[model samples]
Each structure stands twice: as structure tokens, then as C-alpha cells.
Target: MAARPIGLRWKLSAAIALVSALVALALSLLVHNAARASMLDSSRDAQDERLEFALRAYDSGGQLVFDARLDDPTLPEPLRRAVVKGKRATYVEERGDGPPLVWAASQVGDQVMSLNGRFADRDRALRRMDQVLRVGSVLVVLSGTALGILIGGQLSRRLRKAAVAARELAGGATEVRVQEAIGRPARDETDELARAVDALADALRKRLEAERRVTADIAHELRTPVTGLVTAAELLPPGRPTELVRNRAQLLRTLIEDVLEVARLDGAAERADEQEVALGEFVRRRVERLDPEAAVEVTREARVRTDPRRLERILGNLLSNARRHGSPPIEVTVQGAVLRIRDHGPGFPQTLLSDGPSRFRTGTTDRARGHGLGLTIAAGQARVLGARLSFRNAQGGGAEAIVWLPAQAETDDGTPGPGSPGPA
Candidate 1:
């Protein structure tokens, strides 16, 4: 099975949250480092003041007054080495159980003097600041995530609306359009997308209108000539050759009628004249009249309310297509409100199965050829009757066309109600 796709809203929110977290962490680290350095500088200055006072008292009274000593053995080795080599030196000694000690040392003629102090107060303040910073960073991240979700939701809704409009357009709702409020001098990508969709819909509507006019015109123009041709063919001497001409002329006339029906279906002006129908009997009757050789099976008897004429047209077109493009042994099955027609042939082409049939583009093989209007007309008529029609390749290897008739209101006894008017 294919993996489900992630929605754009979640994608955008995750991205924004990640960036916000990184930014917050970086800023928190920077603030912590700067505050730590400032505290350290203040401690250094206090330590220097103590060292100067101790040195001055030793010179005046020949004794140390502060925490000062002559070359203190407890002093760190690195600090002593630095003191002996310079006039003054300072170092910090850290102990695990308590605040770190700050040390200052200087050479005194033949000996070295040193001062030491613990920065317990400063350490406590730094710890408190670290806690505050951690809390602040978390709050920043949370707020940023909330903001991201709000922004993402708004954009997702707008994009979703645009997507719905586009889908309706693809499904032949040419009059549908997307509406978005846009600025005059400044607009975002969503605004641009909405404008493009609306423009495309308008262009499509106009193009379809032009195509419908052309189709109606061509079909109308050919009608008179086609009728006259049929008459002429009938007047020919009765023979095999004359019969062939007459059949061809009648086929031409049928094609012209199919074209006109297609135009009418496209205009969306046809309405279903609903009536109660015994699906099994209807299918058998239509099959017998349309293709006597085709087999019919009433698997589960059902009576539906629908337009009989439109339903028959759908059935006739399917049977005609099966005979023209399929092998022998065509079969029709009626199960409840569903009708299935199958042909033992090569099955439908992949394109037809995937994208539905297109006019004048029959997916025909060497053994089969047609003008490709049969399935299209059938599909259109099915729509006019408010039914669902689909084509697929049967698992055992054959083409199957299925029609799901529209449901009707049930009577008090749980059976389908009597015939009623369809959609207005």
C-alpha cells in the first residue's frame, strides 16, 4: 500500500517550530555566557582590592591582615609558577563541594605574596540566572510553536479552498471559480493562485462554449446531407451492394445523432423522467432488442425508479460498444440497483481505465476500430439519469462497465417507493 501523505499545515508548523527552538536555544546560550563573563569580571575586581589592602598592611605593620600569605603552599601549582615569573598573577581554583576560590599573587623582592577569596555570592547568583534563562527559553519555544500553528492553519485553509476549486474545474464544473481578496499593489502567492484559478476557469468555460458551438454546428450541417444520403441509398436497386450502401448511410446518420446527443448532454439541459422499473426485466428486454446474442443474468432482482429512455440509451451504447470492440460471449448481470456488463476481450486500455474515455480517441487494437463516441455517450446519459458509471478491467481478464442506479425513497413496507420526479 502507498504511504499516506502529510498535510501542509503540519509540515509548515514543524518547520517553523524547529527554527524557533534553535533560535531560542542560541539566544539563551549567548545571554548566559555574557552574564557569566560579567559576573567573573566583578569577582576579579574585588579580589584585586583585597590583594592590594593585604600587601599595604604587610608593608606598614610587617604582618598580613587579610587572607594573604607568603608563598602559600596550598596555592595551586599553576598560580605559583605564574607568580614567580611575573610582577602579578591571578588564577581561579575550583573545588567540587563549594564555590570556586579566586586567587591573586605577586613577587615581593625575594618571596611571593598571594591573596585568596571565595566567590560564593557570585556563584549563587549565576545559578539563579541560569534557572531563569532555562524557563524563559522554554516559554519562548512554546509561544513560537503556538504562533506557527495559527499561521499554518490560516494558510492551509486558503490553499485547501483553492485546491477544491481546481478539483471542481477538472471534474467539468467549468463555471466554478476561486475567490480571494487581494491587494492592488502587493499580493502573496495564495492571492496569485486564486487569480490564476479564476482566470483558468473563465478561459475553460469560453473554450468549452466555443467547442459546443462547433460540435452543434457540424452535427447540424451534416444532418440534411446525411438524411438525403440515406434516402438515395434506399432508392438504389435492391441487391447486396445497395444493402451495404444503405447500412453505411444509416450508420452515418446514427453517428450524427450521437454527436447531437453529446452536445445536448454537455449543455446540462436534459432531465430524467423517473418511473418505477424492474431492473432485471429491463436489462433483459434491452439486451434482447439491442444484441440478441448477449446473455443476461438476474442475480438479485431489484426494482428502481429512473428514466427508462435514458437507461435504455446507456444499455444500447454499452452493448453496441461490446459487440464492436470485444470478443464474443458478452454478458449482462443485474444485481439490485447495480448493472454490470462484461466482454471477453483484451479489456480496456490503461489510459481509459485511469482517465475515463475521451471523444474521438478510441483505444482500439488491430481487430477493433470505432469513432469512440459510444462510451462517452453512455457516460453522459448515465449522468443525466443521476447514476454512477465506471469502467475497469475485471480480475479474470475482461472489460467490465458498471452502473449504479440512483437510490429512491423507500415505502412504509421497506421496499422502494413509487416513481417520482427526479432532480429539478
Candidate 2:
């Protein structure tokens, strides 16, 4: 079988979280880039203003008077040369131990007075801003992940309810309803989906009910004529004509019986009468009853609590199917709560595996006759017994049908009566 799809909640949560993280990362980069440029411009402007102030205070100081802050020896040589030639100059100078300084020089009379200041405070401010932005970016992404998980969980819960309702409908629930999401109410796509599913289920139920009614009426109407035909065929002379007539009547009767049984199964008229069944002995007895030549191989001892009648019906149909559609020394093995019935024959058709058996498929050819209802009836009976029946093509070449029973019941004699309670 193809792998099951992942749930909607987790997919939604992951998508939202990824988008949030990308958005936060982009915003952080944009803010950090703009801040970097702005910080550099502000530092340059402040240095220029400081240089202008120092030059104004030292006017006409032919002896090269300078303020204590601007009198640093780390000024650039080009700035000093420009002052000596009675010109103005500005340059940036860096020292080994501190932040870069902005230096300006001008000549007053024949002496040179230079202005310079370190940009240490501006660099410190920019570094602090960078640290803050980094911390904020991390927090944003973390918060987004948590929010995604919360929203995803809510979406998953609503989607799962719709899924459950659909499953109930598939399992023959005549009146399945999609439940509205719990908590805060809102009209959204999820709500619309729930409405659509309920509508589809209602439509399906009506049509199926009509089809079932038609089938039941036809089966009931045929019973009287089939009884008469069977009696008339029995009274006829012992010849081929009588045998053929009798066979036709028998086939028709079996079809009618199958239809009625299916109707009962659908109407919930069947209930399991759970009883302890010894796996080894039960397998041997059932195989002997159905096909005397078929091989019975019980490798493990086990006891299961289930309806034995349903279990027998299920096994009988499977064996009949094997004989009709397959060449077999049909092999049946009981291992724990699992039973395997395999036949050496052409394996299951692709259509049968994909879509299951149709009740009306046996109406045509010899090979398609009674084999049509075999697997279908087995599946229905298995469900009645709360067991799982699966079909597969075995290795080499053959068809395999496996029945997985319910939990085993622990008992002393392994043959507890129907009403005698056993340990579950």
C-alpha cells in the first residue's frame, strides 16, 4: 500500500514558522544596515562641528595656541604640512591603541594650529546598538516558532474531526455529521470543508439506502419462485435436464441468500457472541469441514475470544475462493492470533486488489461465478468478528489471505462456553 499522508496540522505549523523566520531575518538585516550608515554619518558630522569650534577659538594665535583636547601628537603628517603652507586641511588618523581621530589644520599668521578628536564614544554606541538588534532578532524567531505550533495544533484538531466523520460514513454509519471546530468560532475554509463533507455524506446515504431497498425487494420477490423451481426440478426424471435445472435453482437460491445476509450485515442485525477458541484445534476442524484434501499446519498454540461462527464463515469463503480461482493444495497455518490461508495459483487481479469485490460480478462466466462473493463475504464476516482480513500475493507465485484475530482470551481449558467470561 502507498504510504499514508502527513497530517495537516504539522504541515501548517512548519510553513508558518519558516515564513516568520524569513521575515524577521529580512527586517533585522534592513534595520542593521540602515543603522550602520546613519551611525557613521553622525560621527563624521560631530567631528566636523568640533573641529570648527576649536579653530574659531584660536583666531590670530600666531604662536600656534591649541586647546588641550586638540593638542594630541597623533595628528597626520599631511594635515601638519597643509598648516605650515598657510592652507586648510582635514584628514582621518588612526593610532595603535584607540579609535580613529578626525584631524583639521589651518594657518593663523605664520603659525599652525591643528584641531583633532577621537571617535571612541561613537564606536561604543554603535556596538551597543548592534548587540541589542542581535538579541531582538533571536527572540522574534523563537516567538514565531511557538506561535506556529499553537496555530497548527488548532487547525489539526478541526481537520481531524472532519476526517473522523468521513471514516464513520465509510464504515456504514447512516447518519454521520461533521462537528464544528471547538473554541472560538469563525467562518473559514475549514468550516466550509466540514459543511461540504456533511453534505456529501448525506447524499451518499440517501442513494445507498435506495439501492439497498431495491436489492432487498428483488431478493425477497425471487424466493417463492426459486422454491417452486427447486421442488419441480427434484420431481423430474433422473437425467441431465433435471440435474441442470436443479443446479440453476441452487445457484439462484445461494445468490438470494447472500443478498439477504449482506442486508443484515448492513442493518447492524448481526452481533458477535464472543467465546474462547483454541487456535490449533479450530483450524484443523474448519479445514477438514471445508476441503478434506487441503493441508492444515498449526505451528503455535493460542486461544482467542471471538465469534466462532463468523470465523468459520470467513475461513470457508476464503477456501472456496481459492478452489474456484486458484490451483491449490490450499495451505492453512495458525500462528498465534493470525491465520494464513494460501493457494498455489494465479494471484489476485489488479482490479480486485485496488477496488475489492463487487457483489454482482459473479453473474457472467464460470470462473467468475461463486468466486465473486467469496472474498466479499469473508471480509464482511471478519469485520463482524472484530478481526482484520488482508489479501496479498505471496513470493514465488500464489495468493495469500491472512486473518488477524482480536486479543486472545486466557482460559484454563481453552474451550470456555459462550457466556463464561474469560480474562481479556
Candidate 3:
């Protein structure tokens, strides 16, 4: 089983959210660092002022010296070492149970001064700023997610609409076109896609129309000559030599008819004049007309509403192909909505089974005599009547053609199945 694919909307939304979160986090870190540095600078400046005051008030052993309680000062070891080396030293200490303290030590010509400043007020402000920044970061992430959903949803809908139009157009809906709005100053990728698909559809429609017209005109022109040839062949002497010629003339006539029929179908000139049809009787009559020796199995009697003329044409063409290309012992089966015809010949060639019939291109190399129009005509007729016609090879080796028709009524007994109109 395949896993369901994730929608583009969600994917885009996640990407936007991720980027936004990273931006927010980086901004918070920058602000946090800046605030911490500012607090430290303020503490250092206050300590410098206090150190000057302590120096002015100092008088130690007749040598003026800044006095400061440094015996228990919470100064870092680096700051203490710097002070002992007669260098100015400053450090901030954070008290676990109380408040933070800023300490400074300086020595001037054998006089040492040490000072401490209270940093509780600045620490409280920093903590408040930290809280605000944290809250702002969360809000920023949430806002980014919501914005992503809105943008992603719109994009997803636009892309999905274009996809639907293309799919419908591909399914033979000639009028199905992707409509892109004009006069927009800004056209996005989706708009470009819609325009491209619409252009392609228009070109395809014109090309197919031209091809159909050429086929119809050629077929119409050849019909008169073909009819004359058939008539001339009929008047010929009844000799074995003329037999092949007559048969060839008839084959030429069939090809012309097939071409004309396909042209009509392509031009949408055929309509289903559906009527009640008996499955068993229809198959029996068609088979009898083609070959009397072929076997037919009627598992159930069915009354189906379908275009009788089209159905007849479809069956006639199938039987004709079977006779020409298949061996003896052809069998027909009619059950409910299914009609399967199989021939005990080399199952349909691989090419025929895969690609169906192409006009003028014989379906197989072995049976190259026919023009390959019979199955093509049958397929067209089947489509006109809203039925499915498919070809496959039988299990034991033989060509099989299955026509699935809508069953209006069916029964296992030999009685006439209920006569009702099925979907045309």
C-alpha cells in the first residue's frame, strides 16, 4: 500500500513557520546579548564613580589611599589577580540568594582602592526585558504560522484548479480550458501554467479538426470509385481468378466506410438512438451472420438498452477480425452486462493488445492483409454507445475481446429479462 502524499499547502506552511521561528530566535538572542552588555557597562561606570569618591576620602598611614572592604568581596579570581598586579580590575558577581554586585579594584602608586556597587535594580530590569523578549518570540512564531497557512492555502487552491482543468481537457473534453485572468499586472506561475495549457489545448483542437476534415474528404472522394469497382467486379465472369479481385474490391469499400465512420465520430456527428436489445438474440444473430460454426455461451438472458445499430456494427467488426485473423473454434459469452468473444488463435499479438488498432497500420506482422480498421471502427462505435471495449489474451492462449455494456435487466432463466432503458 502506498502512503498518502502530503499536500503542498501544509508543506509550504511548515517551511514558512520554520524560517520565521529561526529569525525570531536569532533576533531574541541578539537583543538578549545587547541588553546584557548594556547592563554590564552601566555597572562598570557606577563603580568608577564610587572608586573616585573612595579615593578622595582615603587617608591611610599618612599616605592617601582609596579605602574599600575587599577582604570578603565576591570578585572573580581574574579581577583579584589583576588588582594585585597594580592594574585596574572590574567584574560583576551574581548572588544566588540576594542580588547582583559590581566590584572594581585599582592601584595607584602604592595606594589600592576597591569598590562595590549594587546591581539589583539593573538586574530586575534585565529580567523583565528577558521575559518580554521570550513572549515576543513565541508570538512571532505563532504569527508566522498563521500567515503561512493563509498564503499556502491560496497557492494550493490555485495550483489544484489548474491541475483539474488540465485533467478534464486530457479526458477528451475539447471545450475544457484553463481560464487565466487577463489585464493583471502581476502574473504568477499558476497563471502562466493556465495560459500555457489553454494555448496547447487550442492548438490540439485545431490540429485534430484539420486531420478529421482531411480524412472525411478523402474517404468521400474514394467512395464513388470504390462503388464502381465493386459493381464492375460483380459483372465479371464467375471465375476463380476474379474471386480475389472481387474480394479486394469489397475490402476497399469496407476501408472507405470505416474511414468515413471514424471521421463522423471525431466530428461528434453520431448520437445514440438507444433501444431495448436482447443480449442472447443479438449475439446469436451476429454470430450466425459471421460464422455458423462458432460457439456461443449464454449463461443468462439480458435485456439491455443500447444503440442497436452501433451495437450491430461493433459486433460485425469484431467477428470480421476474428474470421480473418483467428483460427477456428471461436467462442462468444454473454452474461449480464459483459460480452466476451474469444478465438482459439494465437492470442492477440502483443502490439495489438497494448496499443489497440491504428488505422491503416495492420495490428500484427503475421496478419498483414487487413487494413486494421475493423477494431478501430468497433472501438469508436462502442464509445458512442457509452460502452467499454477492451482486448486481452485468454489464459490458455487466444485473443479475447470484452465489451461491457449497461445491463437494464438480467435473469438466469430462459425467460425474457425485464426490458428497461439502461444508461446510454
Candidate 4:
């Protein structure tokens, strides 16, 4: 199995969350540094005020006061050396036992007066602020991620709806469309994509309508002349040449009928008259009429509820297709609600197996032998009967076609039950 892809919503949301986290981190760092710088400045200012008072008291009594020191050797060497140079200086010394100490020194004649202040309260406040910033950053990131999920989910839904519409269109559901909600001055790429898809569906629907109309008209027009030709051929003298003409005329008539049928199927006007019937007996009867030479096998009898006429058409087309394009020894098998037809020919061409049969294309080898409408018509009728028809190459070198009846027609034990041989 192929690996599933990551959704657009997650990719967008992650991007938004990462950017939010980075922004939050940057702002937290800036605020933390700025607050730290301001606290340090306040500590220095208070120490300076105390140092001036100490200097004044020393000058009045020739002794220091207010816990002041004269040339304190315990002070940081950088601060003491700066004070000795006859200039003021400040230093912060962090102590393990207490909050950091803020030192301010000033020169007074031949002596230096210094004051010390501690910022335990300020340090605590800063720690609280840092905690608040951390919590706020987390909240910011969470909110940002939530907002991203909301926006991305909306966009992803729009794109998903458009994708579904496109797939339906490819599957021949031309009426399927993306319903986009538009607002003035707020159009986005998704809205544009929806509009483009709607436009494409319209174009395709119109083209297909024209093509079907042409096909139907041509078939109707040729029907009269083709019928007259068959009548004229019938009146000819009984001879080999006359028999050849009659056969060709009949074939032409059949081709015209097939064309008309194709047109009707394309217009989606065919409806099934469903009924329940024994599947194995039905195949045996159809095989008698279609190709008595083909082998028939019924592993275990099963009954199915489906359109008998449509089923016959599906079976007839498959048998005729095999007789015309396939090798000898065509075989039909009925097992439960499944019917399989195998032809010991060059198995269908690679193209036919892959893309399925297209009208007027009987593969690269069988192109001249027959028109490619047999499988197409069979597939169309099978669809109307709500069955799955598939083609594949058999393991022993032959073309095989399998038709699986819908679940409604199947019983769990593959035996006649309440709905067997009843109205569908």
C-alpha cells in the first residue's frame, strides 16, 4: 500500500506555531534583559545616595558612619582601584548566602568612602516577572497554534471539496460541482480553484452533450437507408453472392443499432427492469442462444436479483466479443453471484487491460476484426444493473472478464433465501 500523505492543515499549523514560539522567545529575552538592566541601575543609584551620606559624616567627624568603610579591601579590586584614581565607580557582587550586593565608591581627599546595598527584594520581583513572561509565552504559542488550526482547517476543507468535485467529474458525474462560499473583497486561492473547476465542468458537459447529439442523429438518419438495403438484399436471387450481401447488410444494421444504444447509454436514459433469477440457470440459457460451442460451468447454484434483460445483454456481448476477437474454446463460469468469461486468445492488449475498451478501438491487433462497442456496451449495461465488470489477463494466457453482481443480489450463504427469485 502507498504511504498516506501529511495533510495541508497540519503543515500550515506547524509553521504558524513555530513562528509564534520564535517570536515569544525573542520578546521574552528582550523583556528579561531590559528588566535586569533597570534593576541593576536602581541598585547602583541607591548605593550612590548612601555613599554620599557616608562621605559627609566622615568629613564632619573624621570617621565613617552608616556602615560605611574607608578604602574597603573586601570590595572588588576593580571598584577599589577605580575609587583610588579619584573617580566614582560601582560594582555588583553576587553572594551565595544572600542577594547580590551593590557597591558604590567615591574619593574624599586621600581616602575612599564606599557604601554597600543588597537587592534581595528586587531579585525576587525579577524572578517573578521572568516566570510571568514564561507563562505568557506559552499561552501565546498555544493560542497561536489554535488559531492556525482553525484557519488551516477551513482552507483544507475547501480544497478537499474541490478535489472531490474534480474526481466526480472525471468519473462522468458532470453535474457534480463544488459549492464555494464567496465574499466580496475577501476572495482566496481556494475560491479561485472552485470557480475554475466549475467552469471546466460546464465546458465538458456541453462538449459531451454535443457529441452525444451527433451520435444519436447519425444513427437515426442511417437507420432508414440501412433497413432499405437489408430489404433490397433479401429480394435478391438465392445465391452465394446474394447471401454475402445479406449478411453484410445485417451486420450494418446491427452496427447502427449498437450506435443508437451507445447514444442512449451516454445520455443516461436507460433504466433497468430488475428481477430475481437463478444465476446458474440464467447463464446456461444465455450460453445456448449466444454460443452453444462455449463451455458452461456452475460450481454451486446461486440466485441473484437484477435486471434480466441487462444481464443477458452483458452476457451476450461478452460471449460475442470473445467469439470475434479471442481464440477458440471460450468458456463461461458461474460461481455464486459472479460470472466469468475466459477466451484463450492473446489475452487483451496491454492498453485494453489498463484503460479499458473504447468505442471504435478493438485493440492494436483486433482493430480490423470488430468494433470496440461490445465491451463498452457490456460495461454500460452492467452499470445500469448495479454490477461491477472487470477485465484481466488469465494466468494461463487468455482474456478473462468477470461480472460481480451487487451486494443486494448476494446472500451470505449463496443459497435461495427470502428475496430469492422475487422482485428486485
RMSD of 1: 3.9
Model 1 segments beyond 4 Å from truth?
A: 94-98, 180-187, 366-368, 408-424
Listing every candidate in turn, what is its Cα RMSD in Å to the true structure after a full C-alpha superposition? Answer: 3.9, 5.3, 4.8, 3.9
Better model by TM-score, 1 or 4? 1
Per-residue lDDT tens digits for candidate 4, residues 190-287, read: 77777887887788888988999999999999999999999999999999999999999998999999999988888877888878798889899989
lDDT of 1 by residue, 1-424 (tens): 9999987778877887788889988998898889878887788788878888888888899888676889788888998888778757678787898877888887777788988888888999989989998888788878877887888887777788778878877777666666643223125678888888788788878888789889999999999999999999989999999998998999899889989989998887888999987888889998998999999998777778889999999999888888877777999998667788999988899999898978877887553367888899999998888787899888888889988877653433456542333321
Ranking by TM-score: 1, 4, 3, 2
Rate residue 192 of model 2 by lDDT. Answer: 79
Q: Which digits, one per residue and each the tens of the lDDT, describe model 2 over residues 48-122? A: 566566666655452222352343465567777766776666666656776666666666555555666666777
> In candidate 3, which residue ranges exceed 4 Å CA deviation?
2-6, 47-68, 71-74, 81-89, 93-101, 108-135, 180-186, 349-356, 406-424
Q: How large an RMSD does model 4 have?
A: 3.9
lDDT per residue (tens digit) for residues 1-424 in model 3: 9999998888988998899889988999999889888888888888877776665666444333334753444556777788888777778777787656788877754545676766778878988998998899889888888988888887778778778878878766777767642223236877777888889999988999999999999999999999999999999999997999999999889889888988998876689998887777888888887678889888887878888888988888887788788887888888766788888887787787787777776666855578877888888888788787889888888888888785456565646553422321
lDDT (CA) per prediction:
0.82, 0.73, 0.79, 0.84
Ten consecutive residues with minimal summed lDDT in candidate 2? 415-424
Structure candidate 3, residue pairs in collision:
none
Judged by lDDT relative to the true structure, which candidate is superior, 2 or 4? 4
- The better-scoring model by TM-score among 1 and 3 is 1
For every model in order, what is the number of clashing pairs? 0, 0, 0, 0
Instruction: List TM-score per model, in order.
Output: 0.90, 0.78, 0.82, 0.89
